[model samples]
Target: MAVTRTLEADVLRRQDPELADILLGELDRQSTTLQLNAAENFTSPAVLAALGSALANKYAEGYPGARYHGGCEIVDVAERLAVERAKALFGAEHANVQAHSGSSAVLAAYAALLRPGDTVLALGLPYGGHLTHGSPANFSGRWFDFVPYGVDAETGLIDYEQMRLLARTHRPKAIVCGSIAYPRHIDYAAFREAADEVGAYLIADAAHPIGLVAGKAAPNPVPYADVVCATTHKVLRGPRGGMVLCGAELAGQVDRAVFPFTQGGAQMHTIAAKAVAFGEAAAPEFGGYVRQVVANARVLAAALAAEGLAVTTGGTDTHLLTADPAPLGVDGRTARARLAAAGMVLDCCALPHADARGLRLGTAAVTTQGMGEEEMPRIASLMAGVLRDQVEGKQVREKVRELVTAFPPYPG
Candidate 1:
């Protein structure tokens, strides 16, 4: 959809002409291209409207009912609705909607459970895990002792046995589960059992698959873990924010940690936008969209594999997949650049046992743009062309325009 700005041109010209022109060009480019980034999506107009609502003016420092500032009655209602809807959608005893992003949500969870310098076990970054999961350069690793486990080099799957052994040896305060590029369903029950053996808290970072879980396409981690942290974007298709859900027993600690421990005044506008998104996800059509997202990923994976590209772990059971570019004789960065020239917009991702020979592709953004099975083959063709060295920027750009034009975007 084309974003029509209401800002007067003369006003923008006087204030910041160069910056305004660049931003407008970017908006126009996005409207004309296809997006395949796994962690990105297009928010509904309602969510965007709420994001720019009057709620942005408010400053409600504390929780609902116990505010540190005056004139928060309506803001309190907006926040409570967000909390109630999130809890209902995720089947959690409590929910905190003030986290600014997934990273903040992880910090809040850590604050509630483990002290600084405690031992934590999580997946390795080279094995499809997130930076906050324990990367040495990240705050989590600097503050806490981190132990990591990797996927099997042979099966390209999580090595549960190795994880179990590590848990026994490390005796970590928390065990984090979930991945950014993993292609299979997570076994939360197994993770729970492992955590129980070590008397450690099970933390499920379902930041990527929360929407699938909410749609019943994936298993629920809340039943198996002590705490769950997820982003409102991704499959949720909500505002860019984070949420923490836990049992009633841990509600107080979670709330305190999110507010005074991690952040100050909440972004009331973001919270209200999150509430709107949660409401949209609860609709019947949203589940159908998620189902289509999984289907589209599988179709795209099969097509790429057929064209001689390597699909990590054979195929995907979720909305995202990793296409190994080693078979095409290229690094992830090169492959990503080539595809971008063709108007395809996935990101470079790590491959199993390889440093960086894979590209991550997702169906969420395009699916939301109303592209379906009809366009998957064309996207695959574009990818195949890039792999075969037959497509360049000019050719890909034209083909991409044709492909995207076939599926008219919903009016913004």
Candidate 2:
């Protein structure tokens, strides 16, 4: 949405034009470039309005009807709306919308369940695991003994048998099922079975696809996981925040883990924004949008493979895909720079079983911008040409500007 089409910019511009200019500059940047980032999307005007509401001034530090701060009766309503909407949207028995980010949500899940030095099982970092899963530099690894599982080297798919074997061997306290770049529908049932066999708690770090789940485009993990952690943005198109969902049995544990433990005061503005997004997702149009998101990703992946980019897993079933750019005479990092220069933006990710990095891009943003299956091939061709140096940067950039302008994210 045109965020500045609201009131904050007017007052801020009058009081602090310096910071106001920065805001406008960032808006212009987003408007001009193709945001193919996997974990991003265009939030609706309603969500933006909630984010800039007076709730931003509040400091509610606990659950509804039990906040420690005074004057929280109003913001409590917002939090309750968020909690109820989230539970109804995902069919969870309980929901916690107070976690600050996806990482924060994961930390709280750990605090609620496993103890320090407990063994945990999760996807390996090189094979699409999130840092919170077990990165040595992060608290997850330092606090627990993380046993890593990996995907198949040839198929670029999760090795479920290996996961089961690892779970049985390690007998971990908890098992995490999610990824930053798998580009496929996760087998939550399989993960659940493995966890059950091991008597381990299953935590679904579903930050990427929870939006899809909300729209019924992806499988709901609520039934299969002991805890589900997700971000409110991305395909959900909500504010930048995190939420945790679980059964009634674990609700108190999850709630306490979020408040007075992993985090302090909840951002009422963000929670309000999340409620707006949840309401939007429940609408029928959002279902169509998510379906198109996957359709666009499929076409884009196929087109990239046709352009010799070696699309990971041969293609994708989600909004994102990873592809090796070595065939285009450049590495993923170099390709990213070249594409960024040409007004196409994305991230570089580790290719499964490969020493070289690969490009990871998504259709969530572009799909929200209204480009569909027809535009996917053109995007792939443009990216391939840029990496291969077959097109001038200026020409590619001008074309990108034209495409984005034609499908302006917000129509004034």
Report lDDT per candidate: 0.88, 0.93
**Candidate 2: RMSD to truth:** 1.1
Candidate 2 local lDDT, residue 210: 93
For model 1, state the Cα shift of residue 360 in Å: 0.9
Candidate 2 runs further than 4 Å off: 1-9
Distance from true location, Cα of 116 in model 2, Å: 0.5
Question: Which model scores highest in lDDT?
Answer: 2
C-alpha lDDT of residue 98 in model 1: 98
lDDT of 1: 0.88
TM-score of each: 0.96, 0.98
Clashing pairs in 1: none
Query: What stretches of model 1 exceed 4 Å from their correct place?
Result: 5-20
Residue-pair clashes per prediction, in order, are 0, 0
Cα error, candidate 2, residue 55 (Å): 0.3
Most accurate candidate by TM-score? 2
